[model samples]
Target chain A: MTASSASPYQRLHVELDARRYPIHVGPGLLDTPDMLVPYLAGRQVMIVTNETVAPLYLERLKRTLSGDDRDVREVILPDGEHTKTLASVERIWDALLAAGFNRRCTLVALGGGVIGDMAGYAAACYQRGVAFVQVPTTLLSQVDSSVGGKTGVNHPRGKNMIGAFWQPRAVLIDTDTLATLPGRELAAGLAEVIKYGLIQDAGFLAWLEARMSSLRGLDVEALTDAILRSCAIKAEIVARDETEQGQRALLNLGHTFGHAIEAHQGYGNWLHGEAVGAGMLMAATLSQRLGWLSSEDMARVETLVASAGLPVTVPAAMSADDFLAAMRLDKKNIDGRLRLVLLSGLGEACVYDDTPPDMLKALLDEFPRA
Target chain B: MTASSASPYQRLHVELDARRYPIHVGPGLLDTPDMLVPYLAGRQVMIVTNETVAPLYLERLKRTLSGDDRDVREVILPDGEHTKTLASVERIWDALLAAGFNRRCTLVALGGGVIGDMAGYAAACYQRGVAFVQVPTTLLSQVDSSVGGKTGVNHPRGKNMIGAFWQPRAVLIDTDTLATLPGRELAAGLAEVIKYGLIQDAGFLAWLEARMSSLRGLDVEALTDAILRSCAIKAEIVARDETEQGQRALLNLGHTFGHAIEAHQGYGNWLHGEAVGAGMLMAATLSQRLGWLSSEDMARVETLVASAGLPVTVPAAMSADDFLAAMRLDKKNIDGRLRLVLLSGLGEACVYDDTPPDMLKALLDEFPRA
Candidate 1:
């Protein structure tokens, strides 16, 4: 169906010159051929999805891009964050080779964050990069990962450690796909949605505070608004610093700590967003201790995250030392100094490298594991 | 020793705007701390080399970048084209993670083409790219591979099937390193040098025709002059098409067929330049068949390649079918049709997608494989 005839969709653009693309959010976007047709560089299409997503949306997406001129193939990988590795990306490479796919072929990532990261990375390296489109099926990816051009697999020692900043030709976000999303996974995605508010938009945070219940209910209007706003904030930051040379690093407000939480919990255990939820709390507390975030603001931020059904505390087993060691491995560290994204105040985040180790340790010790 | 006190080095610049870097070609470059120290972004330096090169130049390179504040480490892999794989790159990742090397760390590739390719790729992906310098020790790498930003590993299916176009911060070509290079490997590198002549500068080809003896003898002046000219031609093409979307494909004149030969023979058996030497012969013959090259010119090309002590014949085992299958996997292929870099006439090359398959098959049939 043409976009004109379809239900109104919220469109956000990632304004990277020459490499820019639009993110379309609405129900049944998977079936909108017009949204996908213009971005396809050639006739060949390879939809890379996970086993979990394949059964539910693979055939549906295939039908959307289906045409006699299009030769579409699908590669279904096993699900989970652990699968986000070079080995998994190699599988995608092998599949493309086996199929004799050329540089003209465009890979469509049709799952959540893991598939998007792995598939996009595969596209980036395959023949030194081929065109790819992101069809993010989960809220986490649709709102956060898919919009910005961050794509890569994970190293065993770190999260999202091995990757490329490969932008997709387009991002198609079908909110209807969230019906299949498990409750915990849904809550996990909300963590990133809340992140936008804590990092840059105080107004958005207040709106999220009042509309948290509607979002949890999967209210289409509220969900679309949050995803659109979140993507816009990310897209603006990404446009300004596509390579994370400076301001782009601000988007990782909770990610440095969040990545540590996921790594400590063995990747797939805590869920990325859940860890980010708890990690953001730690960042807020740390920011407060550093005289950046006020105590009342930190309480409000923690309450909003807690009310979203996300974790507000660290896992019981990880110690302050463990947190320090894990955070040191983050991509933001420079010459052994840990650069962190901390709030100067609620709804205002900035990257800082001056967080004293003693204050960082004190904040970490206060969090009861688990 | 400092660069000022040593014999003046021949310097050439690759004009890529913000990514522009200089190529320093001379003896004793490894010991010239002045050339390397300025490019280093941080104190942490990871020297990536091969087992063969480690004992020879590793310590010399370490001293060049060494300072009390600098933390230096080394990662050595088995030396061979076959070792250029995703798995090999992972080992680099593991070492960086183990050492807690952050994004601030810079990787120095301290070997030939294989080392440069794998190490450059590792740097490209290590935390979504960090600073990397190329200290290419082989003739081929200094003249071609290292000068351009084309870095990647080989797949069993195709040479450089998985990689990136990650440009280096600088390329330090210590021609003195050639003293330790094997004879056949040296000849293999010369093939690429001859390629610059055939594809772009007829004058270079004629110059190489006369100086074949001096180059083969590893005369410093002749080698330095050749490397400078070859790098100038490549940097021009690369600046125009950093990502082989256009003019850069011309540099692959023999590489399309050359890669197939390497893939078929099992990479590392035939040195890259040796394969390209034969492949260029095949490409010249085919170009003649297509009426783009004169029969007399083809013979001159073959004679020049043979005088350089490189192969002019394909392996005795590969059939036309094998060539077709291998060439199909090349990155230049589009929509399953082979796009080859063929000569329009001597000293002039262009990317062509319309090569008649029957003529290609006939030409491949003429070459007896290994």
Candidate 2:
């Protein structure tokens, strides 16, 4: 870990051997050309963002990347999770082809997780893989999506049904960009921030519990510290299991249940982090039922999630069968068995495949609905 | 290298460290479950073939994979190079998801280069990649496409413009399948075989020159030898440069010109190997012009290609500009420079980014057209 003295930004490397890359977290990092330029494959750069983010940081990024010898272009797609699809990615490939971009060109994902994922996937397949950089603007993206190279689009059947683990050349997280984020989006990001603490770091969890109000209040120092810790934990895990064969699956502490909510509700209905927030609560409750976590532990999990401004209940219209139907299709399952990441205790997670069907059904049936 | 004494099949391994897998080449290997069963990730199996091959080999493959414990499903896509698009791959994903295939499932690609590429890509992105096996039925695929892990779909703008380097768990080449192949398709496959000789093996070139008639006549021994040699060369190249960072580009001996011919003619109009046949001749001609190959060497190249039943002339409708336009989009090029693989000698190839535009144009304009 290294923080530049001139700027307040801290840097962490995701050590993937030959493909190792750095994640820089700080205020106004996007405007720093020195942060992004070294990672670009060549002079041809394509900036992929959404309509919402285009008006926010697009020009500033362009100025930072612009030079006499470099050719930089931008493709602004419609915003929202609904827009994250192969067709939209095709548009990015089309723009690259139309511009006659070569194999050395770099794709800079300049928005939230949706943009980062689609753009990273586009880079993954363009000319059978090219270089890409992640400039995640949303708090959720800065803390999670941008660090690991899990890039893909959602299929109608599941979330991220199609994707590849193509690591980016660098991740630029500008805490300053969070200033323009909606309060709900900010809250959704805190869900993932809280996730890091619950899964691996009890001390970080206590720290976040203490500073949750300050983070929501947009205190720069508080936000930067939270982002750095989140990225560090994620980067370390990714370095150990770049392909998610074993220990890395623990990071999906809330995703299996969360994907069910996102899919049943239709993509983009509930923001990814928001669904994950509720899903974490459901997992904790289930853990308590399984005798893994006590009721008090479950309460602490719920209070922290709720205090972060996330929902703590399932959608009213969803049935236990709906959750079962969707969870069965999760990517984590193996050989028709539902494999889930569950909490063994605070700051510790384990994958369980033996959760009794009746127990799960009872929990789903009895859990409060929003 | 290991040859099973019970059957006449010879098995060679592609040494990719942890991802290393075996390539079994010989007749009737497809009927042996021992070849494929060990490589499958789990009990869920999806066989992806095309309409043309499904009728011929799908049932036989299913029978080979069938067991009371295994769940087998098949998706038969329409045949042809033009059908190789993101849409076709989407259909494969839809089938897997509809079948409730999970991360532990395996995809078996059972067709020509088009089917293999599409299926491999589908597996590459389906749940961010699962296990896959290559059961290539075409002569072109048996010795070339199946051995290297280059999987992708063609974008309208370019060939294999979207894809990933997802290796298969195994590559099973059933020589018996070629008994039903069209003569022209067989000739196309021969083009790639001849390419192996031209690019990396002088001894193999001499062997091919002597055995050209035997190979064309479908002498099982000659065909098997050729396939083994080609795969051996390809597997070695892929292992050294899995992602085409350097030495691997030499394998694209005639691909730059071949791709231009294919793209201008519209993908399926000219078979990939057929275009490559003509492209190889064009490369040799250019090499001769650059004083890299003597006139005698060029004549040997032309004689070998002509004897293989492949077209050595450019397409009649394509002009210099047409070739240049498509070649400009070749994936091997970097930073707007046109990179081409040219012969340093009869059996050795080199990548040259400094090919003078006028010399290339002159060759394109003067090359004989069919």
Candidate 3:
């Protein structure tokens, strides 16, 4: 194995036999390019990033990929949730084809969750699925979107409404990219970071509480370690249940409520992390109402989110009915019945169907604008 | 087990475990919807067919399905290959949502390869993969497209340019649909039947030579038995190599050349089988020119294609170079090198790479004129 492959973090493999790929994390790994070389066996490489991320490190990324064999190219998509549409995916396909790319090509996603999801979905559908590399530049993508094989473009009816479960050939989480991100974006990303703790990693959440300031300040070691821990946990969940029949639902700790808030707010109004941040708070409160979580445990979640600069309050204009209607439209719902990942305790969640809307709506009112 | 499931045919499952699906062939099976009750698992059912099919047998299929406990609905797509697009897939999704169909709902693709492929692709993308049943209603679909889980829409650049290998929960091949199919379409379907014999079943090809006339007359036992044999050979091949990494390429038969013809003639201009029909003749001739096939073997291929009333000659308007260019753009091309699946013996074939373009251009010129 190359020195680049032997990192301090644990590496998990999703074995589809030859299509297998690895998830790598930990500090001082991004600057090292050798780990990425083998997967880039094909000569041409297209780096897909967005406007919000391009200004910060596109040049440095280009430099790392500079080699005689590499015909490096870049396409900077407009940054936002709105850009995750078929039109954008077509644009990427057009560029790859115009660049003389065939099946033997690699597409590199170089942004946060939206960029990774869209680029990975394009990779999944392009020529009936090709190789893709994820270089996540945000905390949400590093810990969540980049690790799982779930990739897709969205429909007006729902988020990730159209897509495939195409895993990336490799994921490069350069925590260094965290340095220049907008503070709100950082806060939004932290909501996802906290989610790993809520869904399947309580200890990780506690670690985030003690290390929030270091992460926000871009202390390389702390952020890298946090991302590595998150990826390892997610990789285990995905390996056993790639199709999300059971255990995988736990990963959606705040997403059922989070997606409703994002859709109600018209996608871009709230960062995914922001809606998820506030949504997790609401879910925790509902857990308390159900006698599942203790009041003391709920207070701990609120304190951790606040210290990480995440929001713990829902927007004022939104009403409980809108949240319920939006939740009904969530992709997670089965047979028109709303199914949610409700916590029985921290580090555990069960997907409960037959959620009585009135009870949910009534409890949803309890967390209103306090 | 039902009497049919206990047959030697039924015990031979596709056998990919979770991705495993049974291909039920024989007459009267469509009316026996009881065969499908177990697979439905008490979920809602949506039958996706086309105008060509719905007018003929929708009520009967529904009556058969009425025995089940779940709700049954129908979505009719426009007939023909032209409708295999992202636009068409959106309609499936919209229909499901408008009808409040969710994850637990099972989609039954109730037409030819177009319906099976597009519906299967729709299921793969719907909520990031849902369970789908392939109720293949064409001779071509019964043998080939229905068995392999490869599903997707075409990109503007090529045919089947976008898709996935999302397997079915089960495939119900009702032989009765073949009786109502036009003779021309039935002939087109035979191209795949002939492909099986050409690839690895010389004895089956010989059997087809003897029974082609009976099959043409829609003799139930002869044609149904032919289809069962073809699907069995394909199912066994696909169960081992679902992704086309190795042995699966042998299944391509005339497809390397066939895809070029389909794309050059503009998909719908020629039925997929018509293209394969002509393409197979060209492949045999190319094999002869490459010093692989004897004169008698080449003659036998042309004789079978001619008897099926399918085109055994290329369109005069498309030049050899144009065909070559189209083939290069095919997903089958690897690392800019052309890979042609060539015949070695009467029934054995191999994927040959870096094929000589001049040889192909010359053979294109020497094909039998209509």
Per-prediction TM-score: 0.97, 0.98, 0.94
lDDT of 3 by residue, A1-370 (tens): 1123455554666554556678766554556777566667477788899988888778777777878667889889999998888788878887887776777788989898888998898888777778899988887888889977889887777788778888898887765677777899888878877888887778887788889899888787787777767777777777777778878888888887888778877888889888888878877877877889998888888898888887777777778887877787776776667788887888777888855667788867767663
lDDT of 2 at A74: 96
lDDT string for model 3 (B258-326, tens) is 787777778888899998888888777777777889999988998999999899777777777777777
Share of the reference A-B contacts seen in candidate 2:
0.93
What lDDT score is found at residue B114 in candidate 2?
97
Best by TM-score: 2
Residue A69 displacement (Å), model 1? 2.4
Query: Where in model 2 is the C-alpha error above 4 Å?
Result: A1-7, B1-7
Give the alpha carbon lDDT tens digit for every residue of B109-151 in model 2: 9999999999999999998999999999989999889987999
Give the candidate order by descending TM-score. Answer: 2, 1, 3
Q: Model 1 RMSD to the real structure?
A: 2.7
Native contacts present in each candidate (fraction): 0.88, 0.93, 0.63
TM-score of chain A of each: 0.97, 0.98, 0.93
Lowest-sum lDDT 10-residue window in model 3 chain B: B1-10
Q: DockQ, per-model, please?
A: 0.82, 0.91, 0.56
What lDDT does each candidate get? 0.87, 0.91, 0.80
What is candidate 3's TM-score against the reference? 0.94
